[model samples]
Structure formats: C-alpha cells, structure tokens
Target: MIPANFTYHKASSVQDAIALSQKLGEEAKYMSGGHSLLPMMKLRFATPEHIIDISKIDGLSYIKEEGEILRIGALTTQSEMEYNTLLRRDYPIFMDAIKLTADPSVRNAGTIGGNIAHGDAANDQPALMLAMRATIIAEGTEGQKVIPIDDFFHGFYMTALEPSDVLVEIQLPKKKKGSGGAYHKVERKVGDYATAGVAVHVVLDDSGICQEIGIGLTNVSAAPMRLDRGEAVLKGKKITDDLIAQVGTIASEDSEPTSDLRGSEAYKRSILNTITQRMIRLAIERAQH
Candidate 1:
C-alpha cells in the first residue's frame, strides 16, 4: 500500500523541524528512520498531509556519557546501540532488548526516538527504558523540556510530546555497583512482536539484599509499564523462592492484557508470571557476581 499524497520538508535542525510541525499543525508528522510512521501511513492508519523529515538533521545520532548519566541521541539506531562498546559493557540490558527487536534490516534503520515516540506497547525500547529509569528530552518552539520515562508514555500511540515537539535525547542514569539487568520475551518468531516481554534491573547491596529493582512489562498493557508493585516486593529483600513467586504473582495480577493474535488473556498473563520470575532471578544472579 502506498501512502496518500503528502508534502515533504527536510529539516536541517531541530528548531526547523519544530517550525515545520507548528506551521503544518496536527496534520504533520515528523519522520526519522520512517520505520513506524511510514508503515502506518502506507496502511492508511496514518495520513499526514506533510512529512517533516528530521533524519538529515546533524548531531542527532550519537551515544555518550554525560556526568553520571548516559545521554543517547534520539536518532541513534537500534543496531548502533546494540554494538556500542560503552552500553554493551555497562548496560547489557539495552543490548538484550535491541538485539531482539525486529530483524537486522529493521534494526539498521529504526531509531530509538521513533520506537518510543510511536508509543506502541509492542515496541521493545520503552520497556527497557522504564527498567533503566530513563528520561526523555523534548525540543520545541518553546524550548526544551525534560520528561521522566514513566511519565512520557501516556497511552496507546500517545505520549507527552506535543505535536510540534521533537524528542532530541534519551537520558539514562548510570547504574550503581552490583547492578545487573536482563530482558526476555516470548515471540512467535524472529523479528515478531512479543506475546509477552519483560525487563528487569536489579542492584544488590553488600549483604546480598535487593537494594533497588525495576521490572518493566511489554505487550501486557496498553503502554509499557513498570511493575512498581512487583519491584516493591523485591526491594530491600533477599531473593527467595517464595519472594520470587510473590513478585511473579504481583506482576501477573497487575498486568492488563487483551486477547489477540499473540495469545489469550490468560495465556499472556501466565507467560508474564513465568518470565517475570525468570528475569528477576537472572538479574539477581548477575548482580551477585
């Protein structure tokens, strides 16, 4: 399917993109990588009258640590993050999720910004970002604003970003010592969206108690959700068989999954429970080392 007729404008800067979006109003769509928006447009699920191309804008694709936080440019591709030496060593959680996203072709072109900006629950990055406790930086005509990852996602295909705002960077706080994280998913096939996906970030204290933990769920809700109730169950406690079971129960109880081609509601919730436990255990094991 081909997209409907549209005017195209290549933005040379973030400000230019904002200007274009503002001038074009709600009928405009800012495009980067074009993996998410283009497909929807082709299907007529989205029919923007104007395409503001921000892919050509300079300095929007890079990875670097700023102070205690890792700042990722919004245009950084999944493939780039998967292979980034800094991230691969210090934040394997990202690599775990990025490698599982679609296939190589898609990963090569898909931008991290696009993934989160689409606000699709099935997208892998949002869940991982939540687990990492990341933040988003949005630049618009009014200037820049920072939004916590938890508050960034609003609903299905919805986010805090205004139509005229462009997401410029993703900020992730550096994990402390004894920190370990993992991502797991049950998908129908390679490159397919998950039936259920889970990400866990854990930090253990010297006494082997869980000092901090973040559990993120995907495809189990209308938006990528952080399992705060489940995390509360593990925080400050030692990982035990009973405690693990309790966390899994909390995760399953809190998720709001719907029956679809992926699986039945009961089946998805069941998988969520199983994977939640597995990811937590894996994270704890890694943190022990």
Candidate 2:
C-alpha cells in the first residue's frame, strides 16, 4: 500500500518546525528518521495531509554531556548512540538496547527521539528508558515540559506528546559507580519486534544490599511498562537468586497479553518471566567490579 497524497514541508529550526506543525494543524505529521512514519504511511495506517520534515533542523542531532545528565538530541541516530563513547561508558544499558534494535541499516537511520516518541511497545528504548528512569523533554506551542519516561508512554503507538509538540531531547541522569543496567530481548528474527523484552537497572550499596531496582517490560501489554510494583519488592532487599526468581513469577501476574502470530499469551508471559530474572542478574553482575 502507498501513503495517501500529502504535502511536504521542511523546517530548519525548532521554532520553525513547531510553527509549521501548527500551520498544518492535526493534518500534519512530523518526519524524523522516517523509519516509523513511512512504514505506517505505506500501510495507510497514517495518512496526513502534510509531512513536516524536521530532519533539516540544526542543533537537534548530537549527544552531549550536561552536568550529570546526558542530553540526547531528538535527531541523534541509533548508530550514533550505539557507538557513543559517553553513552557506552556512562550508561551501557542504552548501548545494549541500541544494538538490539532493528539491524545495521535501520540503526544507521533510526533516531533515539523517534523510537521514544513513537511509543511503540515493541521498540527497545521505551522500555529501556523506563528502566533507566530517564526524563523526556518536549516543546510545543504552550511551552517546554519535562516528563518522566514512565509517564511519557501512554500506550501502544501513543505518547504524552501533544499534537503541536515535538520531543526535543532526552535527559538521563549520571550513573552512580555501583549502578549498572542492560537490556535483553527475545526476537523471532533479526529486525523483528520483540516477543518479550526486559531492561533492568540495579543499584548496589557499598555493602551490596540492593539500593534500587528498575525494571521495564515490552510487548506484554498496551505500553512499555516500568515494573514498579515488582521492582518495589526487590529494592532494599538482599539480592538473592530466590528473590529474583520470585520477581519473574510476579511479573506474569501483572501483564495483559494477547495471542497472535508471534506467540500465545501464555508464551509471552512465560518469556517475560524468564528474561526479567535473567537480565536483573546480568545488571547485578555488571554493577559489581
């Protein structure tokens, strides 16, 4: 299927982009990497009257350190993020998720903000960002606002972004020395959506009691959900194999999955259980010296 006929507009600045969106109203769709929007457009899942291309916007495509936070511009490609020395050193979890996304060609083109802003439950970063407790920054006709990644994902193919808004940057806090995170996903094939994915961040005190546990799950529900209830049970608890296994058990109780070509509701739930425990342990191992 081909997308319906649409007009195209390119904006070279954030203000210009926002203004164009307002001019185009709800009939306009913003284009970043075009990986997400184009496929949907081809399927006619989305048909907008105007395509406002923001790729030309300057200063919206770099990874830079801002005090304790890493401010990732919305247009920074996945490949850039994957190979970034700062990201790899400070937050390898982001790098882990970046490597699992799409494939070489896709990574060369897909942008971090596009992945997060699309709010696709199957995408890597939504869940990873949730687990990292990152902050998402959005700008619009109204003003700029910072939203926690947990709240940014409203549901599948949905986000907290207002129609007039563009996600400009992601601000991730500095990782403490004893903290670490990584993502693991089960994909049926290369470039396929995840069957089940888990992102875990573990923080250990000097004495090694688990100071914090952040967990995020994908494709087991309508959204990439942070496993807050489950993580709560592990935080401050001694990291035990049994306790982590119990977490895998509790994860199943919270999910709402559907049977499809990918797998049965039962299968997704089971995989979700298996991977959550495994990734948490991996995160723990990485956190240690």
lDDT of 1 by residue, 127-237 (tens): 888887889999988899899988899998899999999999999877667889999999998888999999999988998898888888988899889998988888889
Assess candidate 1 and give its TM-score to the true structure. Answer: 0.97
Q: What are the per-residue Cα lDDT tens digits for candidate 2 across 3-66?
A: 8899999988888889999987999988899999999999999888999888778888898876
lDDT of 1: 0.90
lDDT measured at residue 156 in model 2 versus the true structure, 0 to 100: 73
Per-candidate TM-score against the hidden true structure: 0.97, 0.97
lDDT of 2 at 223: 84
Model 2 has an lDDT value of 0.86
- Off-target runs (Cα >4 Å) in candidate 2 are none
Top-TM-score candidate index: 1
Q: Which 10-residue span in candidate 2 carries the lowest summed lDDT?
A: 90-99
What clash pairs does model 1 have? none
Per-residue lDDT, model 1, residue 110, is: 94
